[model samples]
Target: MSTPLAAALEKALQGRVRRSVPVTDLHDDIIPCPAADLFSNDYLSLCTDTRLRQAFIDNISKEPLVFGTGGSRLLNGNASAHLEFEDRMKTFFGAPAALLFNSGYDANVAFWHSIPQTGDAVILDELIHASTRDGLMASRARTALYPFSHNSAASLRDTILHVLRAHPAIAAGKATAFIALEGLYSMDGDFAPLPEVVRLVEELLPAGCGHIVVDEAHSTAIYGAQGRGLVAALGLEDRIDTVLHTFGKARALTGAVLLCSPTVRKYIINYGRPFIYSTSISHSMMCALSTSFDYIESSAGEELISSLHHISRTFESKLIAALQYTPSHLLALPARSTPADFPSNVVSPIFPILTSYPIPLARFLRNLGYRTRPLPYPVVPRGQERVRIVMHARNTEEELDELIAHLLAWSLELQEEEKKEKEKEVLLATEEVATSKSEPAKDKALFTISLPGTALRIAVSVRSFV
Candidate 1:
């Protein structure tokens, strides 16, 4: 069983084993058990929306459904359903043109791989999604990729300036400069300052040379008028060069669409390998996407968005209050200061409960019937490990209260444990001091009480006693 690949994989996965949790035994009726699903990306709870489900079924049943696309879009898979959906998306999202991809990951890969020709530069947020990085890595266009501080406008400006200085082509407007960003960061659960970022990009790069690309994977079906996304919400849709709206999250469907100009779409169609080679999505999937968008624009969808906002505000306020007295190093939220001029309507469902012991905290919550995922190093930066909690529109006040209570309980338990451990260390130090009292003067050594970094690594010196 130990082939060359197997051997290499075994060595590489020594300490980082990953496993999937099957959902066969974790359902409530036809949908996932909501009581424990705090990690799913279904922010709008559209997966369980009976109306959406029925609409999808009815739409697919309207005519003969194509279960699978025969070939790639460039081949026989270019069905009318795909074209109609793209047109609908362009109108709905207010984009000049729209192109569909299998998923957000696929769209990013295709776009990043095909766009940004030689001599161009792509400035990315340090914490941008891995798919973007993969696309850039696979890109044969010789485009230089630069990363700036996460969500920092100052850093972005600096990075763009540095790139311009380093590459005279970009400065002279002979090359394009693309800025990649996410509307909602999944790990830290923070919104990118889209307005500030767009403004900086326009000011730094040469006129008509700079392009802003935003991936609204975690923000779609949850923001703006009818969930048009942060770009549309901030009135910067005209300024942004390209936008990626994923259907997997709040829309509770599959696939993604890249909103760009007609020229860009045509270029991707010709050069994007993934789009040209991969089989297009089925007609049924297109029907489902159409249905989902229909529901999102409905009054019920508006009500859900309002409910989600209220829940987000309530949860954030309550959690902050609950953690007011807890030690920060043990468990706390990431210290993100909101700008005074930032929009108040930009709320996200993702919440990160920062902790040094993310796995233990996540396990504790899971044992209490709250399923949250722990993100460790590489997923998040070192020292930024956390348990990521995603809120849903279906989440009730009672469920939220119980979750908060359990979090508080965990925090209190940790505090009590640390207190007892400190006492034990003090007693042990005293015992060591007494024991050293019987030793000869020269033999008596300085005693130090050890503590973890969470306790500030207190160095209790018994030198005086000795």
Candidate 2:
């Protein structure tokens, strides 16, 4: 017997959008349509670089290992190549040791679950990546969310103090407290105040009571003189207890590394479930990552970093100019009248256009041949739906101009529709209120009377005329 489709399936399929390029039935000589690329995470465009590709190929050819890891790293999967990559990363990021994971998600989960003891308390930023929060939930430690006031070090310190006071046992060294935060927040593209955080930890945290862990997933290959990430850029390698770096973004590869002290590395290696139970990353993958590390050490990597900086600056200027020309009417309805709806002062490259509803914004962009992602509820709380436009060094000036044009036109149209809807709602509400006010008052004398039975009953009546 075959499974039947649900009734909801038909509705879901009604307006489903397809990818820009068709994946199937491609001809050898066909030239694809020219669509501006705006929906990729390849910020530095390293994935498509001819030189990087050749380096990857060359490394694979020179390496002895190929194909899959037969078992986990603790078992039969650990290879010499894997060890080489780990050593290279450890030196590159200025950490005592480094351990590799298949992906950022796995690495984060593994670190969170393994590092904190049963009696530890994990304090994380409110807006941390979902993976980090998920990892914390899976860990044995008790968790608390601190308010992240858009790079306000004062807020972080205050929150930590509050938590410490609330949980005196943790402060007294009876329990551990771990502070977890990302060096660069994924959604906002803003960075945490690492220096201030370090100072706070040194000044406030009692010995054996707390530690700080920094997630460098978005910062890797995007900061530092050698692109070693923000931690290395700020000379905070020894200051942070652990640093998480990934190759999926700026590194343009698959896999991530956790940088920590030798003792911590040994502990996680022995206890981390993702590393213990799952098959290790393949040797071929290790070779690719090793090649990437080699490229970073070479002169070509310096040139790439310089190019990325120039590109990022150009993109920022173009975006700001475009925003200035956008009509004032295009602005979305002011945030709802609530404390949480208060405007934020944080500024970064990730541009979020708040909307009354995200579906309209998504549909409008789709119709204009631009792909904008919708960040709705669950990801963001209700009433904060927005269209997130991520910029990259790979995007060209012409593409940026085209995107701006489409956004301006779409905004104007949306504003018109919103204005009309508001007017209609106001008129309907006014009419209803007026109709209720005009209704005649009831006469009490007609329904009221005196009755005699076992006892006398009296009713006081008032006269009314309408």
Candidate 3:
């Protein structure tokens, strides 16, 4: 009964079926089983803050009531409120222009799919988000895309050199080179080497032709004064050409903004199809966004950011210490997992703890009331499967301690299971050896070979010569 399309999908998915299951209970808004909220992206725990919610309600009450934009922005969707928010974000982020999108994915797709021209080139990190890749694939300049090793300066330099050799116009300043990066990677939980990347692009590409674009989706409202992001934290806001900030994570709302030059803003307004064809953000969401920004800049927001950092550092230190005796094949951290590798003042809320047994580990933690999800192959690379864990301002020391204790218990249990399995295998091999030796040489053709590091035997059979 399988159609061609259905068969194709089955082959592609290979038994890995994804589904939409709500984490919350059917009757309640809280997470099911009353598990701790460590699996979501709400880093600052702003989603449940009563003050922010009250402020949003107040702002919504002042606005003219409208549930949805009637049409696309080019038609009847463009509101004065939208323009006002864009202006506010422009001034807040210290950018010349700002344009809103429905989500970060929309912004990335619109920007990457339409911006780079045929003569221009885009050199990106290998670990760039899938949205950016989809945009590049649909772009006219897709042929010119080049990916360098993740966070490797030398690889970036080589990629630039290759692009220059292949496209001489880029070297001559007749064409532009766009360097794409994420301020804080979602999966790896590591910061990009922005300073090093900026210097490399400036050194290699033509003086004014290299454009560095940073997507601050994960870092927005979590770093810098008033949550300006990592580019601002490093005092490199003036150097970066474009920055994308999404509000869904720490802001506890939807939509994103692209901060760029006035010229680039005008270009996207004209050429970006996602922006042109899609309805604008809702009126109430705009009010919520404003309230969120007001909170981020307030004194309470600063305290929340500090609390997030303190909790993150505590978790990282404890987890690293726990993994010290663990086998790399069982559990480990990425090479750049140490604090010294991150920005001096920033400790990311996201952690991608590597393990081949992600599903089992996540299930164990979830059963213990610490909710986490596994990222298996295809979401990440095969050997790099992990369980993504996030820290929030509200998570306390006692919670972390309990989670770690459960994790260690699981690890110990796994080790014990492995020991018993090996013993079983050794006993079976010994029985085989005994049986082989008892048989006559003419009737039996068997030999046992010992392998190093374990008391196990491999049986080989040979024909007896008459």
TM-score of each: 0.90, 0.78, 0.89
lDDT of 2 by residue, 1-466 (tens): 3335755564444423321111223342132213555555555667777898998988799867689989999999998878987888777777899999999888888888787887666777777777777677778773454545655677778877887897788778687678888877656556787877888877887875768888888778766766787777777787788889888987888989999889888988998888788899988888788777777667887777666556556655676666665544343322211112211211233455665456655666766656555665545666666676655556677777887677777777766765675565556545544555665434443222222111123332222212
> Which pairs, if any, clash in model 3?
none
RMSD of each: 4.1, 11.8, 5.3
In candidate 1 the C-alpha lDDT for residue 106 amounts to 92
Q: Each candidate: how many clashes?
A: 0, 0, 0
Q: Relative to the true structure, how large is the alpha-carbon lDDT of every model? A: 0.83, 0.68, 0.83
- lDDT (Cα) of model 3: 0.83
Which digits, one per residue and each the tens of the lDDT, describe model 1 over residues 1-466?
A: 6799998877656535442111223352333553556678999989888988888888888858648879999999899989998999999888899999999999999999989888888999999999999999987644588899998988988999999998899899898989999988988888788889878888888899998999999988888998887788888889999999999999998999999999999999999988898999988888889889999999989989988888888888888888888888767887875544556877777788888767667768867666566776556677887888788887887878888888888878877877987787768767877776876545343444434323234445565344
- What RMSD value applies to candidate 1? 4.1
Give one digit per residue, the lDDT tens place, for model 3 in 65-89: 5478787789899988799999998
Q: On TM-score, who's better, 1 or 3?
A: 1
* Candidate 3 TM-score, true structure as reference: 0.89
> Cα miss at 5, model 3 (Å)?
4.4
